[model samples]
Target: MEEGRSSKGGVKKEYKGGITPFVVGVSIVAATGGLVFGYDNGIAGGVTSMDPFLRKFFRATYRKMHQEEARSSAYCKFNSQILTTFTSSLYIAGLIASMVASPLTRLYGRKPSILVGGLSVLVGAAINGGALNVGMLIAGRIMLGIGIGFADQAVPLYLSEMAPKQIRGALNMGFQLFVSVGGLSASLTNYGTDKIQNWGWRLSLALAAVPAGILTLGSLWLPETPNSLMETQGPEKARAMLQRIRGTLDVEEELSDMMEATKTSEMVKHPLYNMLQRKYRPQLVMAVAIPMFQQLTGINAIVFYAPVLFRTIGFQTNASLMSAVILGVVGLAATVVSMIAVDRYGRRLLFLQGGLQMFVCQVIVAIILATKFDSSGDGSISKGYAYLLLVMICIYVVGFAWSWGPLGWLVPSEIFSLEVRSIGQSIVVAVNLLFTFAIAQGFLAMLCHFKYGIFLFFAGWVFLMTLFVYLFLPETKNIGIEEMNSVWTEHWFWKRFVNQEFHIPIGIKTSSNT
Candidate 1:
């Protein structure tokens, strides 16, 4: 059994209590990768419109002359395409990297994997800020994507393991909060430097390095997940790390739970491979499908293309940038609200309500766009409609922030057993990253080809997601990890999806009251 403490000096001491602060602090610090992820994505929304910077850095070239003028002008149609491609190709690379993250995490401990990812971001940020050409920028973006892949895979898993049962939902919501903060920071920075486009975009991109550096340096002092340590190292090492992380909590009980969950003692060769077998397929499906559905909602398209979409509604470039900033502010606010509400109301209810809300917003936006409410004689949209579009987009963002933005990470962690948690999360994130890549690559094409139909497509997805949440997802707030395995075992809807039949053992079912 792991070590425990006796009451001393009139204080009731627990084995895990002493280490809790360190665990929480380290987990939050390591999770800054989410911040870097958001910063890289958010910077482009405003930076794309920096005309002076573009003109200064990407000047017209005679070799690409059109009618005796340089055709490679930053505002030229081709240059716009180049910029869009540069902005999105990294997402594609990240999508591919996410697919491998599960296997990588299984092999390397989460802490080291995250450190490597953080270093990659630092490198990518430096390369991107100094890029002399579009090709180099694209390469830098790919590198950043690789870093995100690692963070995306590891951060949630680490948080799930470290957080106490009572606060897991709230703590996981921190990931979404950081993501919003990163977006807000980028928007504010871009807005502040709108007048100095030459240095503004570069500066914003480079700022991503600061968080990456902090996370890398801080992780050195952080303890690995006690579960990982126990399974990979021996119980003695795991106990020491747990004592450091949990402080005065009942370390023996926690260690016993970890041991019970570990598959290493059995004849099974690999825990992840064992999970992929017929027994755990249901958990696997929920894990992968939740994140896949999250991305299919087209959140990334809105995030990455917000400025462009607003521009289409007739706003001037600067106005659109400002509007995008407003959207970021609204998103941040809604996410904060979600962080508070998620633990109180539970994950399933919020998801159902949020999905339905997004559906309504998307449909309304589609209608407005389809009717061309403020288009000029030449079929170009006017600036007046930009305000309406921005409001609707904000509403849509609120819906997403309150639902999938947090629950996407929260639910998967809650649903899967500890044995498959890492691999399951990796797969879930991989699907999300893949769809994100698809949206990033095809958003402009869909916009140009079908015009308002893109919104309609997303609207349908939100509707489906709403239905899925109501049908399959269970409330997981305040539930212990060990108790979660039985939730699906007892529910009829979940039973149909789970491949292996199991009974909810006695003493496992607790009060459903929130």
Candidate 2:
């Protein structure tokens, strides 16, 4: 039962006992939290474009959508703030919930937070499916948002803590893989349900409960992570759980690391306030920056409005939804690729490559739109060019799904020391949901004004984020969660802010690298 511990040089021996059946099964179950998140993300865009959905809640927007407006105004057809509010409101609620869930997650174990989130989604789905008025709809959305915030805040941390050091990157990526799967499921549901006429949208919205329910029930049987047990229970219980999870009794070394981390965590009177110290500057910066950059990449803007975006670019109603389904498929496949390669190739390389790939795809899409559809041309794009646009969009989705989509959750979850890990993940979810709200709220409006230039706006952001990663982000591949500080301490720029002595107190031989 040899396991890799974080070393300065690199991982010594890979955990031969990593990827146990119990651990993999639990990781898969916990990853369903991402399914709820992705399903909701994919559902909003498709449902918004459904004729029945719009005619019921937003007749004016529906009327505008059907009218023979100017080609330039095509982007503005669905630009109603109130309509976008239905989608964006969830994110605003999620932002608040992520912040509120932080202390609760720390006080309790991660499993309770996940359970609460799932139940909220279940109730919210029921509300949404039965809603007859705008008020009911928004209220339901807020509940869903709360579910997402809590789930998003805790699941990554849960996965990170549960995963073995050698396979941590691959296991953490299970969250994003399920997210892509959930999005694809939503797209396929929307594509099929669109034909059911008046009540189809309800079915689409209601089906969110399936994943939520699974997560809720599955969480009941799941064991708390060894780290959580170490903190809340005791070292012996933590060791026992670790043995069970690892399928081995030779867990003394790993349990010792958890004990040391817990000791440091115990010293902190207030984890949130302690995060503001100079020693934690790098972790705090990453907690904020990574998720912030993830949203700014404009992936969510496209994902949340794919159906509307395709229709705006001249696809018919059915075609737009089908395009979204294709995007989801591509995203799901790319995530699988990421799961395989993240640990092998490392996060830094993928981040740079994915950023570059997305940047190129966006610029190409922008150029195609700029030249193909101008004032002189008819509002409609040529069928050939339309297919090309979809291809480019799919390529862009591939880049994002493989990179920022998963790593955004992964990096923040693994970076912080145990003392601030929960709070750090809360910040990650908060920043993610905040910008997600902004993008969902303003994307259509921005498209109305910036038109093709909006792609350029996102491309600019992609370039900056890629540069940020190249300069600041250290490779966290194969590192134990407790030894994360060593990665920062060895970095060129981050080392100045990281205090090795603070993270590894006197006589703690946690890492030979340090």
Model 2 clash number? 1
Query: Per-residue lDDT for 6-78 in model 2, tens only?
Result: 3244444433245689999999999989999999999999999999999999998988877765344666778
Per-prediction TM-score = 0.86, 0.96
Tell me the alpha-carbon RMSD of every candidate: 6.7, 2.7
Go through the candidates in order and give each one's C-alpha lDDT. 0.71, 0.89
Residue 367 displacement in candidate 2 (angstroms) = 0.4
Compose the digit string of candidate 1's lDDT tens values, residues 439-488: 77777667766667788898898888888878776677766564466566
Candidate No. with top lDDT:
2
Off by over 4 Å in 1: 1-20, 52-82, 264-273, 372-384, 496-514
After aligning candidate 1 to the native by TM-score, how far in Å is the CA of 496 from where it should be? 4.1
| Candidate 2 lDDT score at position 369 | 92
